[model samples]
Target: MAEVLVLYYSRHGGTRKMARLIARGIESTGAVATLRTVPELVVAGETATPQQADDPFVTLDDLKNCDGLAFGSPVRFGNMAAPLKHFIDSTSKEWLAGTLIGKPALVFTSGSMLHGGQETTLQSMMLPLLHHGMVIVGLPHSEPALHSTQGGGSPYGPSHITSESRRQPDNDEKDLAIAGGKRLAMIAAKLQER
Candidate 1:
């Protein structure tokens, strides 16, 4: 079956929550949503591996095989979290092979503050996908929440802010993430139809 990969990295679980909501939106459209998480970064000097409490790690092959993608990350100074960027950086082989060419893609991010670079982080996530020739997708103004939301969704993508970390998505933000995923899947299906 064709699948939309909802891939992300979350240290405080905020991004992971967004990923789940997006996955729900993808599956609501009858498209399979494959949720995948990346492992914690291992430093060069670290002898011991960090054990992830939960969340399975993703492989490059997973990204290569997906029909569409919903990439998410926590914002780090107006940029995507390092682990997610590290994964994107490693996709050079796929870029060279044109493995992602024409695949529909979208991005989402969580920030600590209202202006915590969420849009910038989302844009940063888009750069590699653009370089790989994947078609970019984003939330449209047609979504009612986009007009009414006092928090998070943008034409660039969806985002969230939590009171504790300032990066968790509020209810509206979660809805926007799902809407973005649904739109991406619909677009992917349309591309396939064409």
Candidate 2:
């Protein structure tokens, strides 16, 4: 079956909630949404070991195999979280292989404050995908949530403002995320026809 990989890293679970909403949107379009996340960073002098988390950690093979991607992260000083960036940096092999070329991709983020770099974080995630030659997708104004969301929906992608580690998505944020996912899946399905 065709699959759209919904991959992200969440420190406080806020981004994870958004990931789920996006996955719902993807599946609503009859495309598989494969939700995955990156492993946590090893602390200073800590031996690196495997983790058994709620969602399986992402592998390069998953990227190579996915038809589309919804990449996300929690904002960290106006950038994507370190774990997600670390994984993206490791995808050099996939980039060299052109594994992600032409895949439809989107980005998302969650942050503490209204202007805590959510949009920039989303854009930051897009740079790597663009380098890999993936087609970038984003939330459109046509999504009514974009117009109404006072918290964190952007034309760059869907986002949520935690205000202080709140993990739940408000109505407009949920609507925008789902809309973004549906749009990405629909685009992926169209690309598959070509």
Candidate 3:
């Protein structure tokens, strides 16, 4: 079976929840979704500890082996969190190897407020994937949730608005996430067939 890597960094469980939902969507299409998270970057002189409660830290091998990728992060001032950016910055070897070239990739994010840079964070995550020559997959308007979602759903990718509280994603957000994941898997499968 083809594998889709669902990589993310979650500070307060919002992004993590989105990642699992996306993985479920990926699996619904019969694709294996390998979920991974990056380690937290500790400040100098600070004690380094595992930030992720249980998810394995992502490795270069995950990037090389997966047929597709779904990157998720909590919005940090209109951008992806530091840990995910740090992890991607370390992928020079993979870039040189062209491991991700032509692979289908998508991005997702969660933020504290409705206007809190969710779309920009998604776009920011796509920059690295584009540099690696991967094809970008986005949620299209055809998804009904995109038209009806009052919480979070965008043409760039699925997103969640976690204003004031880290509430569970609303039904519209969930459906859009599932649709994006399924769309990514279907595209990956088609690419593999060619």
Candidate 4:
């Protein structure tokens, strides 16, 4: 099966939940999805050693081996969170080797408010992957949820708006995520066929 790496850094579990649902969508398309997370990065306190969370920490090898990628993060001032950024910055060797070139990619994010920079966070994640020469994947208007989602679904990628009163994504958001994952997996599988 084609393997797609699903990587993310989530603080309040919103991004993590979206990642899981996306992975499910990938699997539904007969592709394998490897879920991975980054370590917490803090500047002031005792710097904690890197450790695995519920999902194992991603390695350069994951990038080299995966047929596709799904990168997600929480919004930090309309950008990707620092922990995820740190990990991406460390992939210089991989980038130099063109490890991810021609691979398919998807990006996702979660925001605390309805208007909270989710698209920008997704774009921030896409920038590095674009430099790595990955073909970015996106949701299409054909997806019914995209036309009507009020929580968080975008043509750029799947997103969740965890507003002040909400944590879990609504049905529309979840469906979009799954559709995006499925679309990514299908594209990856098609590419592998060549």
**Candidates ranked by TM-score, best first?**
3, 4, 2, 1
lDDT value, residue 31 of candidate 1? 93
Query: How many clashes in candidate 3?
Result: 0
Please list the C-alpha lDDT of all candidates, in the order they appear: 0.85, 0.91, 0.92, 0.93
lDDT of 2 by residue, 1-194 (tens): 46999999987888999999999999999999999999999979899887666799898889988999999999999999999999999988888899999999989999989988988898899999999999999877788888888899989999999965455889999999999999999999999999
Positional deviation of 187 in candidate 1, in angstroms? 1.0
Q: How accurate is candidate 3 locally (lDDT)?
A: 0.92
Task: Score candidate 1 by lDDT.
Answer: 0.85
Worst 10 residues of 3 by lDDT: 48-57
- lDDT string for model 3 (129-149, tens) is 999999999998889999998
Ranking by lDDT: 4, 3, 2, 1
Residue 110 in model 2: lDDT: 90
In angstroms, how far off is 124's CA in candidate 3? 0.5
- The segments of candidate 1 whose C-alpha lies over 4 angstroms from its true place after superposition are 43-49, 165-168
Summarize candidate 1's per-residue lDDT along 158-181 as a digit string, tens digits.
887756635556677878988998
Residue 39 displacement in candidate 3 (angstroms) = 0.4
Each candidate structure's TM-score, on Cα atoms with residue i matched to residue i, is 0.92, 0.94, 0.96, 0.96
Please provide, for model 4 over 58-109, each residue's C-alpha lDDT reduced to its tens digit, 9 standing for 90 to 100. 9888888999999999999999999999999999999999999999999999
Better of 1 and 4 by TM-score: 4
Q: Which runs of model 3 end up more than 4 angstroms from their true locations?
A: 44-46, 164-166
